[model samples]
Target: MKIPNNLRLIVNMRFYLTLCSALFLVNCSSKTDHIEMVYGQTGTSLFQLKNKQLAYTVKKEGQMVLDTSLLGVTIDGKNLGSNSKISFLNQDKVTLKYALNGIKKMADYKGNIHSYEITEADGFKWKLEFQLSNDGVAYRYKVPGSGSRTVLGEATTFKLPESTRVWYFERDSDWKLKSHAGEWLSADISEMPTVSKMGPVQGLTLTCELPMGGYALLAEAALYNYSGMRLKAIGNNSFKANFTEGDQGFVVDGTITTPWRCILLADDLNALANNTMVASLNPAPNSELFADTSWIKPGKSVWHWWSGKYVDFREEQDMVDDALALDFEYNMVDDGWEAWEDKWKKIAELCSYAQDKGVGIFVWKHSKEINFPENDYTIMGHFLDSVKQAGAVGVKVDFMNGQDKYIIDFDEALLRKAAERKLMVNFHGCQQSSGEYRTYPNEVTREGIRGLEVNHMQEGPLTASHNAALPFTRYVTGHGDYTPLGFTEPGETSWAHQLGTLIAFYSPFNCIAENTQFLLNNEAIAPALNFIKSVPTVWDETYVLPQSKIGELAAIARKKDDDWYLGILSSGSSKEMTIDLNFLKDGEYSAEILADDIEAQPINLEGLNKEANLRQWNTAIPFKKLTEMVSVEGKVTIQLAANGGAAIRFIRSKVEVK
Candidate 1:
């Protein structure tokens, strides 16, 4: 069905009759005038013109949304709209292996819109799945039955014409262009207005103009991560992903690997948390098909004491000792170790001590420093190995500004090696994930956005927008190591807000990033940590629950083997949140409340600024219960000061067997 450029027009208007329910047909002159469209029976259509010029219209059934002047074809609702003009150098030179969905179950979806025939070029064969959906178009391609090991999708053969041009749409006029190789054009529209006042959809547009007179415009929500760009590659492969664009696409394509598989998320996490996918697609986990996956484990119940700019191992040892006392399984020693290799030996000395206390230590290493003689990859690897040698379980690799293909390959290889050596990984300043954890389970966490730590360190107060914005924005593609659950100084909220991080921030190896000495002062809040630690990061389900951001409030819930941990948070405001306790097994349970004292309480942020006694924490609150939803409701009201919030933990009681 490839259209020849010489063909003036192919208007098989008859196909339109088959699809348009007769009501969609419009009376027009039979004389092929300025426009021509040939529709197909299998939910596909083709459009072409002789002079390489075009114009058209696309409309959904009931909505008044109209997109006019579109010159590309669409399958279902997906538009294969490229801004770059494509020329077929060899139409007859087909490669059956260069077809889409050739990798089979590894990259192809079981339910897809189109099945394309394989093209043969020399001895190679390729399959291409070019389909359209109500939302956008997608191109899936693969080389049939290639190597035993996983090869980059770009290694296939989809030769582009000598020169092709492409462009994308944009909402903002004045945009900055950055240097990204293989990237013809780049624009940023982070400040666009919301398309709708509510609901999942927020609109932002990105346009990429190719050198060859063509362009591609991707219009999506203003949110981050959930959006993407399409890339035309050599051979038969087309790269499409969220954030990652270029040859690096082979290393970290979000659509193919980490499209937030809801089932995998459910199996890895919990069931009640599964509601986040009501707005989008979630690839089901492959493990559940035919095996007991109990070995598939997860956890984020630890403490991360950052070493970046602050490398005090002696202090860190004290912190480790404190974490061990708190019964935490993991403790991360953040950035800044190469400079203190001397300190590492001392930290290494206490490694067995920490382990003897049942605490696993995680060291921090720089990704680029892996090559320094004093700090190269070998020594860094040895450093990690030494930690392992000393009985630590993991290392958090950070500060990788070089997110190149080689860097990605090296990082993945590093994780694989570390896993083989029985060590876990946490990435910082790294590229977006590609579900490599399913391939290498030890890659436990990542810091991909401005997380809570940013809020504590000399920034404007962490707005409710940061929490409300993440789900549709950052959390769409993969897990985030947002280092949740700390009610110490510098936070503009209460212990409850910190508690909610256990639910809001989806980090498997959770970090109670504050000192345990701080929590011991508030034993009531100590139980909140126990509840947080008890809840598994791997859940049966996860949910971005319905709530209001008007008054600094957010909530999330996780399900773990019949126990549901629902954590609710409110920032510097007194607002009521309604929880359907009915979701729990019809039973009564104790609710641990952590709120702020409404009256003025002396709080300090000195410790956050490298000063002693950062902030003295104090809170006043009324704790009550609800007997009936209609008659009386029990909620902890927190009129918190700036940087103050509240937390509530729903501890599910065991149900009696009948």
Candidate 2:
């Protein structure tokens, strides 16, 4: 069937017109209105440098809202909104600055009365940009000329701002309650937080405001190139940075330029104390199209093996087979995988086995030591080539501590090379991903938080609480591999809590965080695993739902095909709670709910495929009138115990799909 040339021309014209319209909207939007307050009591602000004028102002709004500025529109007669303020925690302070030394505007942001030309450059292009007001101060620097490499990733920050008195419960915590920083940064910078891409996406992050007016930053970076997104330290080849009182921000004045680079700057400790925002920044592809926004869509659930901390080369084959039977996609065989001379070949075999079982393999290797003695991509490329030859899907690269020009260059180079090899990556033990995922899709997940890995504990802190609070905070920005699943593991406090984590945490490749054999102990947890498999990583709507002291609860509803997966997670005590099914489609459903069950046969992992039928339910729901109800719907009333939760799979057959 041949079509007319005129009709074809019209279609082509429409397509180009649509593409041009989208590009213009993305590149020409106002910067001042990017960060606006929709609703809230916190005093926030928006600022930008354009049209030869520096406009800065304050604002306040509720959660999940952006701050807007009519001033730019009023002053120049242009209705433009800039992402000047993404989001932030509740704290009172003044003076903030962020300086980026390598930023070259790609296009001009033409405002009402002003316009600034854009410049595009590769490598470390030196530049400085900062902002200071009553709200806070932020300083940033970007280094150019460095290779387009991303070495560091998943930075877990620990900061102590200089303004804390005795413990006050009203405050998020006497020592904790600081998850909103990631949101604040997202709202302010229009960016997402990132994690390291190492060992199945589990890393650490902590930032604190000290008692006397100082702040400390702690983090980790990855060595792999998932989709070519990463961070690296440029100076000292070290992973730690400190800021003293009276300092503008993190000092990179004398930092060396290795394959990694990093810089810190702040106006005061108080402002530093109130700043924290982390999430995936760049847009990721949904189907490996070099540029698909769906790929960048934030994922909150993952399954992996590192969380168990199990290291045994002899048992690698058995472990790999077990991981496949459990319905996991990405597996991380850390540490010991690289201990032998032909270890790469062994890993290749394991990857081949995993692929046959419908699972992707991500073998682990240290960033600093990989290809060591030789210290270059040539050797690294050979190793990656072997992994690819063995049918491996991805690699978990670890441990880059700082962000230097060289580090950034190396990171970018590695991503490019990894992309060429058709291998995805997971970065670990490094800095935040500002938005590199937008450019790379194979780079699936990273770790940049103090995750649920039963590791060393610090003084006076509820690490578990911090872990629970990250979803609404840092996760909003990007995909986070919090590494939440565990059964008979060292870090989990309760079985149900571990189950709830599947709902609380977000990641493209959510790690299982448990030993393969350990899953056999709790047959009840099979429902949780099934829930993890049934639920989609992307989301439609998310709400804190409710906040409490004992533990917080969160509700998330995700859509895939014609079904909706609604998950409810609780951290504190078990109790009866109500939920409205109004978000669901209008009609009846056959729901298979996997929740806290006191009495259920132990789950046989090998027979997991057969258990799917055990949890299904037949129920009727009317979402049309659901909004008018004062209480939760009848079927929504679920009973949860301390550290217990539920995952409901709503399959509506009342309406047929085309």
Candidate 3:
């Protein structure tokens, strides 16, 4: 039941707590100054708001996980939750359809919801809504009043047990407002305040191990029109929400609704890897805007930029021809294409040529050229129109580096513009994901994780441990365009290991960055070509093996239709891992494996970047092959070299004839 604004506050607090807890079926909480708010059940989890205080506490399974922390937002230099009155508004159920353009077995979102009202001292009002589910708790602030408001910042904070361990990324020096495209780091929650000794510890997407029973992945969701939020260490085991522009702040016009502050609670790492809480907070696509999803079928692509970024009209046609041979859906023309003498005319000719062979062209556009606000959006509109007119299926928007409210707004506007032109989107040089894809189906993939392209170009080699950490850390938020499989450079891992990345990382518009001529004709890769050719870019289901650990090893199985694809990545040292086929159907099935050859000496290929040498290559580290018939109770075992990986495929067999 909702408390009316005119309802008088009870003069006696002790009596009010008792009345609300014992006699009334109210949305209010349990006895005395300590009020239990989130879904008032006896056990499990509860978000408590202490009476006579504006702070909040969190408990799980009757164990304290978080101590009292501040709860309020500072708007125009006014503290909204201070000297204010709060009343429980109402309770309802959270229900959402399982709709997505592509990704794992589409997850469902259902929970119990409760609302509270916070009326400031001057009578200004806003709403706080919390949704509690078995997966976790998500809450957000919604201001009912309209008009432009400069948000100073939020007072929300998280105080955890000192013993909690955290896995996160330090903020990149260039991008102070965001925490993405950086090396992964770890520290105890207690050590966070002093982490400047290690590096900056401000902008973080943290996955923390609670001292009690479960894990909490602290992140934000539905980041459409607000300054992006990151956590700043505040001494001890506490963190305060830091806005994108720091003190200067950003303006939110019209209705002010912030993204959901989420804690994805899970019992094990597997559940954590598969958490859908981020997507749960965002609304589904507008039915009228996205009535036809037939244009959204996802598939693999052949990319020219990932291979090197040097593009010309003639070279692009070769990419399209290679895509046709591989039966791929799209051919990406990355940066440097615009430098062509007649870029548009050539792009149109290439798109026309690829269209006849069942291939679509995805052109690249720099955000600096079209995404700014001065030109009245005409530049962006014209670019989208030109691509659609050229028969291109998608646009890759690059160099969107900030997360302040203005940049966030521009990102959404670009998606809307591309959607109207029926063009898919791949956001590169962008901020980390907050499950915005649930609302924008045209967004096929995005770059938030430090992916393969960076690794190939950087001075150092990509460590397998970083690759191993992705499944649990980065991928949990949403799809990562990790443009996997860069074969030209090799400093770590065997050739087969690079092939395995094609299955490990989750990117709907999967782009292969290897030398195309080498990938097609290298006799050494012939045995594994079939598996690579048919790998599923979008999955029906995913299972993280129980043996998996962050930054050490990642063994996962994904299902598409009747076949199962397994990707295993191991780091630090050569080790043996096992796969139990317990999830397979009852009948026998055929399995084909492409794995690291532990004993073979890797062949030296210093000239892989040279076209003359690439075509002449016929030898490399042997990809150990295995074929067997297995059942639900059977197991398949493989050994991995240091920084090694493998890809396996399984197909169920038919019943035998009598």
Best by lDDT: 3
- Alpha carbon lDDT of residue 358, candidate 1? 69
Give the runs in model 3 whose Cα sits over 4 Å from its true position.
1-18, 22-32, 38-53, 101-103, 175-179, 196-200, 374-376, 610-622, 656-658
lDDT of 2 by residue, 128-212 (tens): 2222222222222223333333322222111122131111111122111211112111111111122111111111232322233
Output the better candidate (2/3) by TM-score. Answer: 3
| Cα-based TM-score, every candidate | 0.60, 0.55, 0.91
Instruction: Name the 10 consecutive residues with the lowest summed lDDT in model 1.
Output: 96-105
lDDT of 3 by residue, 1-658 (tens): 8765545455466678777664433333332434455543212222335442356666665666667676778777887775556666787988765855444767876688877776666778788777777667777888765688888998888888878988776443664344277656667888888765434345546888776756778889999889888888887688889876878888888777899887777777778877888887888888877777677658888887655537878889999999988878989898878888877888999999999999989999888899766665888998888889878999998887878887788899898888777789999888778988888878889987777765455333556778888887778888888887766664465676777777778888887777777788878777877777888788887888888777888887888888888888887788787889987768878999889887887766666665222323333455688899998899998888878888888888877699
For model 2, what is the C-alpha lDDT against the true structure?
Answer: 0.40
Global Cα RMSD, each model: 12.5, 16.1, 5.6
Model 1: per-residue lDDT, tens digit, 1-658? 8776555243445556455523222211122322221112112222223433222222223211112222322222223322212211111211111111100112212222333333222333333333333222333332334222222222111111222222221212111111010111222222212221221111122222222322222322111122122222212212122233333233323222212211111111122123122122322323433133332235443443532326566666666676665666766766654456676566667677676776777787767656343323466567667767766678787766434345555565576457656777888765444444444446677765556565445432344435543433344445667666544443445555566556665666666666566655555454455664465665654443455231244455555565555555555546555554444555555665555444534443344323222322323232222222110133333343343344445555665799
Please list the C-alpha lDDT of all candidates, in the order they appear: 0.41, 0.40, 0.76
lDDT of 3 at 466: 80
| Segments in model 2 whose C-alpha atoms lie over 4 Å from true places | 1-55, 60-314, 370-376, 404-406, 455-464, 490-493, 520-522, 526-529, 539-551, 596-635, 654-658
